[model samples]
Target chain A: MTRAFNFSAGPATLPESVLRQAQAEMLEWNGAGASIVEMSHRGPEFMAVAAQAEADLRTLMSIPDDYAVMFLAGGATTQQALLALNFAAPGQTCDYVVNGHWGKTAIKQVGHYVNPHVAASSEAGGFHDIPARSSWQLSPDAAFVHITANETIHGVEFRDTPDVGNVPLFADFSSSIASEPIDVSRYGLIYAGAQKNLGPVGVSVVIVRRDLLERAGQPRADIFNYRSHVARDSMLNTPPTWNWYLAGLMFQWMLAQGGVQEFARRNATKAALVYDAIDTSSGFYRNEVVPAVRSRMNIPFFLPDDTLTARFVSESKAAGLLALKGHKAVGGIRASLYNAMPVEGAQALVAFMRDFQQRNG
Target chain B: MTRAFNFSAGPATLPESVLRQAQAEMLEWNGAGASIVEMSHRGPEFMAVAAQAEADLRTLMSIPDDYAVMFLAGGATTQQALLALNFAAPGQTCDYVVNGHWGKTAIKQVGHYVNPHVAASSEAGGFHDIPARSSWQLSPDAAFVHITANETIHGVEFRDTPDVGNVPLFADFSSSIASEPIDVSRYGLIYAGAQKNLGPVGVSVVIVRRDLLERAGQPRADIFNYRSHVARDSMLNTPPTWNWYLAGLMFQWMLAQGGVQEFARRNATKAALVYDAIDTSSGFYRNEVVPAVRSRMNIPFFLPDDTLTARFVSESKAAGLLALKGHKAVGGIRASLYNAMPVEGAQALVAFMRDFQQRNG
Candidate 1:
């Protein structure tokens, strides 16, 4: 059966091949006499699964030897609070770069632990572009600088990692983690909630530098203490074993599909196809973001007539494009083209958009 | 194919029937083009799944209207800290009844948020018996009292819920939740990590009374806040969707098997077979826990001579019985007969034990 292309921002689409492989192994995992979900986390079978997952992810990201890969629970929202707990202690402050809805939400959530100083914000620009690095007013005494590398809602992204001087840099790459090649050494911490380009929901991947883990020496913090997780190898508690197993399968799939470099080319091609359709539509189908900061992962666009928005989503769904409805905060339509979304799906969406524009205009 | 009888503590054993059903619907669930794992959590399909799971659980436990059932991420270990964060605020004390390894671990983790007072403990008794209720030093002004209804490792269980007067009672029923009928009104909060009898390891079920949730009006408790989880219907964050779906299936299966009442009878029969073997072993096999407080879920026993322990586990494996090794902290054998373990499995274990005793003794 031909699978419909899913464009959900999260809890999003996964590779069909990966799903088939998981289905085949649902009952018996390689003659282990039990499914991976039924295996104990402390058992040797699951240990190998966990170890291989971390190793494959490390190799794919070209992660430095100094960085420790940790698989945790809770989504990116939990990480927003956890980052504050681990990096900024009570009375300490952190620099935050607000580019879009996700950045603003991060600031609001992290404000509970530390005073979040807005280093730079693009809210004045209607979240269409990132604030220039020179305009950022970074605090010298701040614990770290936080940024959302790609904003899923606004369809904006930072093309390069920002240098925060002596302060450690942390990025919530929830939407863009595996889409392109990245220099892992540039950031002290990188976290991605695994609903997007990774595997499934419920498991979060965190890459933390060793030195930054030392800051988690706070007396009272419980689950957010990075040191505790690092020491126990992310098994300080029973992890979301099924999600971790799925993630391992995803990593293996990514490797088989020519790794990150190949993924980067495909992502570029898919994004360009959709962007080209939007560009050719003139004022009919308009994408708000500036070309320089537009995301390759998520593309948000709108029709000239507000009434046409609902019609567009309904028609698109009928045409086998799902989850095309934009986030409520950003009205119109959003097409999230993650790693699992094939280029053919993007071409189909572009073709549909072109046909809709000709008829509506 | 005949499935092996698995007895690993958690992420342990699931009903083979559940696995078969899950395998059948792995790619397309009920003619829905998407797998349950692939569907959006906010979609109507998944909403039905999440709602049905909560409804089934409520029916199984006889939960009242005032109590909210939340399907949350993180295991029971996270709940230990979360319970302290929600109920036991700073400067307040929470009482902990330590019966075994899990109880002690909960106390140590809860120490991060509040002063955890060890109201009663069985560690002094080699963790083989539940502490007498009369010996407990109940604190009048305590925020809440915590207990492990069934200790998976030490094989000790509270045969009956303790009366904590007006202080709210919170029990971690990780290993015992679905094995028997539980009175929900007696406790203010009850949580179970889903690896045992529920489903998988990614999701934890939290049932909290409305008034107890009112106590969690703090500013920054994050995902651990029970009120926030209840307010959002466990969708405060993207929950462990697949795990929740799997848990719902297990709940349905339990219902088909005649709910917790029928489960209790089957559990009693299963526990009796192993315990009876130990009782009639005539100095060959011995169970150390006091009979009145012995667990009907986990049966931990020892050989008369310690030298045969390795042989016992190895021969059991050869006979198609797996994971009979005891927890590292408790150096003996433990048979965890959660709801998924049928009477036939328990009988097989008993038959294996009798044969081993006849040959080795």
Candidate 2:
């Protein structure tokens, strides 16, 4: 089994080059005489690696000086809980624009610490579309307006950033981050688990407005405080060094491939290829997401029945097109076209889809 | 340079065979068609990897069926915070037996959630000794008695588990876990960051008595709840898949090498070699730790002055001994003799020390 076009939707496909470099350095990184995994987070060897990663990320994302970046361990779900603990006062109103499964999850994580008001939701419509910006009923005293920029499970995305007046805007950009360019200064905070668009699992990247760190949101341990992590340069404790290092490799690869603008163009091309197949499949396939707001990163579509969906998954795996199974929350098929998915991989998937439709339709 | 003997603590050293296996499998793991890092945590391949790791660890440690094992992120400090949040009520008393820097750090993480009473501390003695068990002022109504089983920085270890009446005993075994055989049933909870003796940096092993999961500790998010993680088999969210996978390989390697009992004998030999060098140095070099409690894991020793110590570090690195620099918290030279550090590595280090002393003295 050679490397396949993996569309597993995070811990998804990584650039093969990144994997190769990591493999080459697995025994001893550079001249350090130890794998990056075995070195201290504070040691000079890893410190340089950590710094280069941060600098590269900042360059790749065009992150501003005022925003502090953190490479943390517990992924976005943990960050979801920490958002309320670090930025919101106890029981403070937090306006959550629930567009899909991840947005709902974001709200669930904060229920104990905040007054999470559902400003708008697409769940009433089975999470197939993003709620209109005009339909939201936000709290005036909300600590932050939270949104999932791209919902991996629902395959719904906010094509445009919604303006939320005075309150800071926060977003979970797990699936869509770095797939394209974004105005980083517009959001108070943006967090993403590295597995999807970035590099690997176990580490997450958190970008936050530095002034927000002064907020004494709630009583919490120092380990839970974002300020402490940022102050320590994300070496608050022994960081997930290997994960961070792998992610660094990813950042460098992304930068070498001409950064977010280049990825945006590639992602647009890839999304079009797959969506074209689904649209032209007529009765054989259907995607419920509105064309205007369908996620370029994750495209969830359904076949006629459960039997065909299972067949598509197994057949795709056999055909070297992998992880086309949709999230269990919405059973069908989901093809995630994250940053690393080459344009050729999308073309191959579309070809597979057409051949499958001809045989099964 | 080729791989050297890496000895800096936590994210310290790994078995060469484990590194070789990981290096071989980094591109694609076990015909899974993707790197383990690039697979979903809930996918069959990673789920099997995660399960086998847990089973192997249970076999290695002789953990009882009554105890639940969890592989988590955020390392030991986060576990330190979660320990208080999961086991003790808000403002409830928790006894902390502080022996070294890490013990003090454990107490620091829980101050917001618990009334942490320092029942005993060896800080006044420059953390050169573990506090006497008989001298500890045990709390009558404490939720749990906490201890650092081995202090990585101070080079002190609790050679015996203290008998705490009624209260559950919890230990941070971050540096010394799986280095020797132990009675898992005696401790209510034992946690270790995998960077040390286990395998990698991101994932942590948590062994907890099952009955403790029923305790309603405090108000916290679902992400912070251990019972939720236990229910999901540590898949409450996307775990660090690569880290978890690498750890599984380490468990297999450890088991094949005759488990903890074999490593215990190896660790004793390695610790003895270094300690003998420091002990016989005739005032030129010294280890201040009390002999009975001197950590067989990390041995921190000092030279007569700063210049010789600096020279030793640079010369050692050039001599193919890497990361010989001591922790910034306690300066001088420190050698960590983890389960993975072969007896030959220790022998080489002692040889270097003798050669350097002959020239420097």
List the global CA lDDT of all models.
0.87, 0.93
Ten-residue stretch with the least lDDT total in model 1 chain A: A216-225
TM agreement with the true structure for every prediction: 0.98, 0.99
Question: What's the DockQ for every one of the candidates?
Answer: 0.62, 0.84
CAPRI quality band, candidate 2:
high
As a whole number from 0 to 100, the lDDT of residue B226 in candidate 1 is 79
Evaluated at residue A262, the lDDT of candidate 2 is: 99
TM-score of 2: 0.99
User: How big is the positional error of residue A343 in model 1, measured in Å on the Cα after superposition?
Assistant: 0.6
Query: Candidate 2, residue B299: CA error in Å?
Result: 0.3
**In DockQ terms, which candidate is top?**
2
- Model 1, B252-306: lDDT tens digits are 9999999999999999999999999999999688888989888998888888656
Candidate 1 interface RMS: 1.9
Give the per-prediction TM-score of chain B: 0.98, 0.99
